[model samples]
Target: MAEEKQTCYEGSSVQSFQFYLEHSGEHKAILQCVHNLLPGEFKRVAEGKSSLDVLGVGSGGGEVDAQMLTLLQSTVPAVPITADIVEGSSALTDNFKALVAKTTNLQKIPFAWHIMHSEDYEKHVKAKGVKKFDFIHMIQMIYYVDDLAESIKFHHSLLKKNGRLMIIIETAHGGWDTLWKTYKKDLCVHAITEYRSSAEVISCLKSQGLKYEEHVITNAFDISECFNPSSQTGQRLLNFMTAKDNFYQSFTSETRAGILDLLKNKCSTQRDGGVFFNSNLSCILVHA
Candidate 1:
């Protein structure tokens, strides 16, 4: 067996992680996209069945988890829920706890917060000590895993029969796809790894003997203000573009100029007051 990799969140100070969460509205939007794609009947079945147990892998700050819990409560009031958050970051876990404490609806659901890496969660289940969950969610965090197949298999093992593992990823064919594919040389140092697409995920799941339902949700981000040097978003973008060593080293002078030019053009258009960057989010609902 291969050694498990430590999670990104491990050993990070809670304050630093909290700062990331505070600026993570974009991530929250992504979670909302996943929540919208979840099967309605599953919510009903979860409510009608025994207590619904949910596990959120890479659940950062619990903002997304809180939103999903609200949706569950409103849609399936009878399903008693116990949400176990498996987070790698202690700082992020603290932020998640604070968010839970502040949110009334989240308090209604039986919530257990676990500060551990995904591999640890898998090991716990393999020991046959943990209860099977009705739903398992991993949103936007799959890219960090060293072994995607093993991660999926672990999640599959955690589910009760007929339970669903819903994963959302950035598609390889979206507008963001173009940006990452082309600029990763310059961007990889600062930005995260390219995510697996919906098709790739489906194929992988099928290879593991898991049946799944998949869908893509497209959304756009307006970042016109981010391009303007005077605007805060623009300044942020500028700093992000210039601060990373990989970005500066990866692109030729001309290519770097072109990328910045594209950013400027996209950011300045007044018709929408921002550049509309479209993203295709792939949601895979797996039956384990």
Candidate 2:
């Protein structure tokens, strides 16, 4: 893995994500998945617990955080929650705050925002001698971390008795995985380069002798545009998928063509007269 200075979230990465969300219907898929998991997981953790302390890593937009908090509230209606959200992007943090400000439901829950990455949060807690958390969540944001195992360990250590650490990531053998693996091999070196899935994280947990449960969240995207060589949105979608800026111009004609063929043939399937790429993601609930 070569050292990467820039990430998809840095510049064009944000635009790429937004583009994918608009075109692919992944936003709905994500929310549906989160909604699906909340009831069981929240009930399991909130049982016999009167109050909750939560630490959220990579809590982008805070929409998902709000949802989980709401569910937790419903599970233990009398229990109050104190949430600390970790987000590195100031723009995203502000966006989350704005969303929270607008939502009446989220206003009732107490939130303390930490404008930093997971590692920074670890250090901050250690420095302040912070207590353990009852529930922790890392949503769609682990690709930005340096070491998945170490990060998981750090967050797990912050859990209190009967606490749960929930992690959500794309599956290893999905279209997203294929695109990212190809991108790193051919295009650029991103520091946090590994495109990990729930399977991989499960393996990590098993190796540590930790108990965990896995849930599958299936979704797909219409990547038919990538077949078109001249579509700007297609190229930007490629950039988003690969986390490379101007991906069309970054590679040679031969490489670009090869990448497109890989995405079309290997990553996607022909269905309903469109190319649908199934993104198999998973949510893991861990308890020490």
Candidate 3:
């Protein structure tokens, strides 16, 4: 019998993630990386073209989408842009809609929301005869997909000739990987997989028979600002690190205490006050 497929985002993880996003300063970091990845000029380039259709795959909370919308509105005012947000979580979709309502720039653009899994969205696009999008983006969410190559192909199919498919991934290179490797035994359980390198992303895109351009954009966060035990940010981080009950149980009280202490000390120190983490965003600007 075939093994059942594992769901990427669980309820507990989603709740924890929402909390973490609010406090961890990752939102800012992500926004910065994305800004550097796709400068305002790209929007102008797309606008100079004939047709404009943009799709954001796995658009969680619509934070990045909101930014993209703002860029498009400013750079390509003449182009009537249609953005389709493909997200599976209803809660996330709801939050995205609320954000859209609040943001003036995002509200001005014509947009659609599809509450469907990435795979299902691909199928729907194929069946509905929607073949090409001017631009397609997957930001920090591709790691969750079961089959990376297949997923890339699906998104590639949605691109028009010479259209660009951009992917922004958080590089698992610096302190982020160091911390995870050090605490993996005590902090990680369930043997989840993470794509940790740019080469892997490049290889996957190549296997899909797509040619692309790549750029590495790096940004850092000061963990000191959010690592206090008594602070809301610190608590959120704790909760995020301990999402699964069984996973939490794997660590001895002493080990848990030690990790917390380490985090606290690291956050408090002036020399390393900034929990410096960098993301090398491998953007594959593909042509169809």
Candidate 4:
């Protein structure tokens, strides 16, 4: 068996991760994209099913998962739902469960938690001979998979007839795309780069002749804190984005300054008198 690789999100301190989200504005951007995509407007092809089976890959804290499920319920009010969540973090899994317990709308919805990475989820489900799902969602988490083609194939295979697989990833020219690509080539050999951008994923889908639709969501994060070299919060943001501990201190001063300058000039834009790291989020819906 191959050794499991540790992800930046899984290895970092929870507080640092939370702080990165807050400072980077990814939390709201993610929710906004989910809200835009999960409306009752989806074609009711799976209309008459008695129960809906939803698989949430890398569901994180479950806040977004619950929101999506609530929207799904509105579309098909009478169908019972079974949400099977897969996340690698125990803390995030617990947080998701707590969210389910407290939210009235989610309280009535059935849920199962799988505290494992996406690949592990596949292995466990295959061993148990689990059936397919009516809906499977992978939101902003595909960048961590080692093989994007294999992962997409597996996720698509797990969808029942007329089932939908929804994926959210950054655009080809987005800040994250540039930063991750640079870091992958220069620093981290094990870094995940397959399907890192919407363009890449779309290319894969086109080559495979998969029927899919893509939507774009515009979002930005405040990178003003990163202007100060001595700022602790700024360092944390850098560390999280690069998936490196002590990013500023890890590299030579010249290299560190060059990277920081690149981030400031190339990765960010000055908007409304604020330094915003512009992001282009692509929502790809694939029908089986």
Candidate 5:
């Protein structure tokens, strides 16, 4: 809104995301879900294959992608694996490349990194038109796509027989979701923004008569700093949460107070001397 002096996808947005991740701490439960689910899916996809083709969309910094790929390699150790990762931020792409350079464990897995958004990656692959993958994952990435339905279909089409497409997204009932939904019209004015949850994805799959399984990853984080109106760290967390500039100052005093009250009473809980919000996330396994 207000022409967005700085949007969430360019410039320093990479630092914004890093700050959010650092403040949110480790999402162990989400990682655990991936660890538990990917092995079985890898076995299913690699059943009759000697090699694996995987795609990662919006694979920021390649942290989760590395984890999932490592698990897949362990599950089907004999199968050679190739991965094509798409990311929009060059800063993040550089970080991923640096991580890849130092991580000896991932050396055996050949990676093709495309430092671009999901829509461009779609256009890139359409030129070849003959490529398909045993596994395709869009981790915390569905929000940044230009066309939600077409993007989902495009990825689904890339799945080989019995292959799995995994999507990780925020749950509809989290503090982030609560904030986004309330301010959705403003935040989603950007071409790269759309706030959708696993439920929406599941509904889309069901509407298309596709098969899918859903797993909810329940987690929480201490957001006590957000209550402090003067804390810069708090501001960074709030900026990432809202993906908006001048969040508190932009709102009317009455509106900001209401928002703070709603955040505490409806979206989070008080525990262990910290204000924690249920940053619940979910993963949907769409099968081909």
Candidate 6:
């Protein structure tokens, strides 16, 4: 185990993230958001516009972005879409580019992909005096941001009138939140990334007096393997969960044991012969 601590973003951790995506209920939650609110919201935003501008923060592999654009197309046919995708990972960018290449549906959407994190994107926008966007979204990516209020305020400012800022994050008081709250000092990842949830976002919006709509998505993930000390996949998943690079082997036995106990008893529950995490999410739509 290494002496130094690291955030989940450290190293080439995309493989573990992909694995987590596949194993978790995150996709289902996204689909729920799309079906329940996004289509109508897209239609509302596009009703009077000849062209739509969208900014996607941390658009990973373009899957959700593609779905959203497809919804936009369905809602308002032949409406021109200009999309700007900002992501930190080149591999995800490559995957997004490949996904776009193979998918015929998004051919009409003119896309500009920027290989940078959200903070850098903000800098670039400030330097370039970027135009306001009709829509902006960040899905499960808020955790990595340096300043929650600044990021929220900046993104909210970028929206055109009657526009929307979409943010999806883990719900506060969920198992993950409890775990982070209990062990953040030892973990040390919170300092780097804020390690927050929907509650913080909502609080920020409320404090900012930003008008918004909230959508709650309840889902769970299989965490049964987390108990297996020898399972490499389990260790990686734990690392991803805690935003720690080497969570299982890097910590003291007491800390690790306590964390495991919290994971089993506090953060998760058992069902269907598997340990399911309380991995709920809240999707907030800040109105501008």
Candidates' C-alpha lDDT: 0.67, 0.77, 0.65, 0.77, 0.79, 0.83
**Per-residue lDDT over 1-288 for candidate 5, one digit per residue giving the tens place of the 0 to 100 score:** 223222245666787888778777545676899888777778888998978899888788888877888898889889899988888777788888888888887888888888777777788789867468989988787877666888889899999888899988888777767877776765566643678877678778888888888888888888888889998877777777766666787667876777677677777999888889778888889999
lDDT of 1 by residue, 189-222 (tens): 4325544556567778889887887776665555
For lDDT, the strongest prediction is 6
Query: What is the clash count of model 1?
Result: 6
Task: Report the C-alpha lDDT of model 6 over 174-256, residue by residue, as the tens digit.
Answer: 98788887887876445244468888899999999999988888988888988998998788889877666788667899998
Candidate 4 collision pairs: none
- Looking at candidate 2, the ten consecutive residues that score lowest on lDDT are 1-10
* Candidate 5, pairs of clashing residues: none
How would you encode candidate 2's per-residue C-alpha lDDT over 1-288 as one tens digit per residue? 533334335455555666777887765776787777777767777778778899888876676777777777776788778888888766667878998899887787788888766766777788888868989888788777777788888888888888899888988788877877776666436635566767678877988888888887888888888778788878777877766678777789888888888888999888999888868778888995
Score residue 247 of candidate 1 by CA lDDT.
Answer: 42
lDDT of 4 by residue, 1-288 (tens): 766556545545556777776776666776786676666333354566778889999888887788888888777777788888988788888888998888898988878788777888878877887868988989878887777887888899998877889998888888877776665555554445442789878887887788999888778788887778788877888777766677777778877877777787888898787688867688899888
TM-score: which is higher, 5 or 6?
Answer: 6
* lDDT for model 6: 0.83
Better-scoring candidate (TM-score), 1 or 5: 5
TM-score of each: 0.77, 0.91, 0.76, 0.91, 0.92, 0.93
Candidate that beats the other on TM-score, 3 or 5, i.e. the better one:
5
Clashes of 2: 1
Better of 4 and 5 by TM-score: 5
lDDT (Cα, 0-100) at 212 in candidate 2: 87
- Model 1 weakest lDDT span, ten residues long: 237-246
